[model samples]
Target: MTRRLLLSHLSLMLLVLLVLEVPFGVFYARSELSRFTHTAQQGALTLAEVCEEKMEHGLSTDLPGLARAYGRRTGSRVSVVGTNGVVLADSAAQAQALVGRNVSAEPDIATALRDHPVAGTRSDASVGGDVLFVTVPGGSDDTVPCVVRTVYALGPLKAKVHATWIALAALGLGVLAAGALIGFALARSFTRPVRALERATAQLAEGRLTDPPTTDHGPPELRRLAASFTKTASRLQHLLQAQQAFASEVSHQLKTPLTALRLRLENFEPHLAPCAQDSLDQALGEVERLGRMVQGLLALARLENSAIRPESVDLGAVVADRAAIWAAFADEQRVGIVVADAATDVRVRAVPGALEQIIDNLLSNALRAAPPGTAITLATATAPGEGGRTPAMAELHVIDQGPGMSEAERHKAFDRFWRAPDTDHDGTGLGLPMVRQLARAADGEVTLEAAPGGGLDAVVRLQRADARTHRQRPGGSADADCAGNARPHGVMAARGHP
Candidate 1:
């Protein structure tokens, strides 16, 4: 980018320089040529006056010698012509060829006959080639019988003009080169900070949040940008480290009290009446629930730190395991838990523990909202690949015959700490969001929709694992089947679903 900017700056500079310099240079060279021509014409007029004085004093015999002397000194062809426009003498040319020439017919000669110097520059196809013609009347007396004319070739002046143009072009090129170098340096200085920021951001994403950038060069804007990014990175690092510390501290602190509570409960069991036992049992349940929440929080924090480690797992087997875990709980709630495709040969690449946790959370939430005796289905199917030609993907779906979510609710379902207003259960509200994060880490996706009958359907789509070691047993472990069912405890249904 910096190189591109520098090149652009250089191009504009060169364009502007060319616009201003080319015309002005040409005009300056022409003006110099005009000045030289005008000076030569004025000299001729003065020389004509000198010749007229000599002629008046009876030195007309000396006209040829004077013309020759002046013409040789100034590199001009000088001639003296009589009043009738007849050449009297000539220098640097044969006198006889010009002596009888009718010079009055020539425009400059005719103008000179009027007692004024005919002065201007012109190019012509003359034998002398590209000449400057200047003619002047003899003396101050208009009656004088002579005029002086000077001719100069334009070739030397043309050479000087060409040289001046070349010099000007060279100077402009030098200026352009200097400007380009300066612009490149400036562009590099400006973009350096931004480049550092990019690298630092990449590092932060890769979990290297501690090492910060130390670039502070270029313009004030760049410095400020670098400073802002550094500050933000520092703040983020502190916040994450603090959260990790807090999670650790909270977990440690809760364990000590939970252990004490369990000991107290054991003591109460020895001295308890039947009523007291029930109260103690309920207290134990609350304590255990709190312990689970803390454990969940710790797990969530760790997952946030670094998740997405995936491995191949049999999708069918995974589905069966989830089904077995939830079946007993679903039965207790008077709801049927069905595991479909449990006998199929399907596989997926994902974090098994995380996938199971997501299934458990979704099932748990669904069972709480579902009517008793309604059947909850855990199903697995293969997804079609690109162009409908590649290997099928593994799709795990949990559908409950529970109250379905509204569109607006579905959109917010994956937001952390988001719970539908109609939900009447104890929930941390982190479940769905955690599930989504895990799914994303595994290079997969999770979505929720309305079940066909009237309930929420949660679906997880994952890349299919290799089918090299697939096994299809008629019956698998009961624990496998229990993995996707929810246990109802009064109004709040909970437990790890498939």
Candidate 2:
């Protein structure tokens, strides 16, 4: 797989090289041909001028001498032609073809007769082929006119251009090969680090972060990632060890009271008076409280050991159901309970039971601290951000109008067994901590703030459900809107009717 990946990258690089170099090679070859044509034309014209001088003197007066001299000087075939297109003097065709013979139909010669010397490249069988032809008319005073023509063979130029093309083709192939090699090296360099990281993550998932990794060589980012994974693994190992220790200690602490409560119950038949029964009931309540504490401790341990799985839930109904259960307890304590009607349809994504437990714990704590006539405010709604289409999330706030905690107390509120110093009320003091654990486990968060005027306020925030899962039922109450006391909140706000 790795080799295939590297080869794929190399192939792409080679393809790009081909795209850029092919046209450039063709264009460069054409440019060299153009330069060759220009240089040949200039030399041919110079030879034509000299040949015209020889033509003016005729055959007896050094015509061959001048033509031979001109041909030798310019490296071209020099010839003279009369106005009737007959070859008069020649340098290459053995200077003997001096008779009248019409040769005006030749493309290059005919063009030069009517216009400036028609200098261009042409290929022919005789005279070493592929030559530049140039013809110029010459006379003394426009009375007797003759044309001098020169042909410079471009065989050497063509040979050099062909050789250059071969060399460039080789160079282009080399460049493509070199690019593929470089690309292969780079792909290997990049993939090696990622493959190492993948193996490390697999080990970590299997709880094997106790030892360090073997290979630590790669780019800086990969090195940093390895370091981070090692650190995380170390921390997780320590945390698991700590949780096991805590679980053991908590279990030991709860066992003695549980044994004592069971013994007391077993021996209670001998003391069955009304007053004795009442005292025994009070002892049983204490035993139940201890059991609840142990259960909460187990829940906390499980939270540390487990991972979060988030899903949609309606918090409004969770609050209302909790309020209903606590309403009976609230009445017994002479406290007024009010579950706000407005939150009946609000919903958010979270663990269903965990969120309910958080709500229950917070409400239980609030009821303990709240005054008799004070109302506990349970509200649910969606929170809006600065900009964008979707609302941020759904929020559920449980407010109590009791005496609020000090800043110091608020900070310590979620700590296990760290209740406020002033309160003489008996409790396991694990309520708030358990609430926090459950909130975090549900991929949600919990915050404590001062209630309106003064009191404890517990707020839970979570993501809203997708639109497909949200449906409005007109006559439905909070009970029906939420599944198991959890309902939708963030969606209700998005319809602009919040």
Alpha-carbon TM-score of each model against the true structure:
0.57, 0.57
The global Cα lDDT (0 to 1) of model 2 is 0.64
lDDT score for residue 170 of model 1: 93
The parts of candidate 1 lying over 4 Å away from their true place are 1-31, 50-72, 77-81, 86-99, 103-105, 126-131, 175-205, 209-236, 248-296, 303-404, 424-428, 435-498
lDDT of 2 by residue, 56-119 (tens): 5554356556677878886877777777788766777554665466778977667666655666
Error of 1 at 61 (Å): 7.6
* lDDT of candidate 2 at residue 392, scale 0 to 100: 61
Model 1 per-residue lDDT at 203: 70
lDDT of 1 by residue, 210-301 (tens): 55666557678778777888898888878877887887788789889998987888788878888788889878877766665565566567
Best by the lDDT measure = 1
RMSD vs true structure, all candidates: 10.3, 11.3
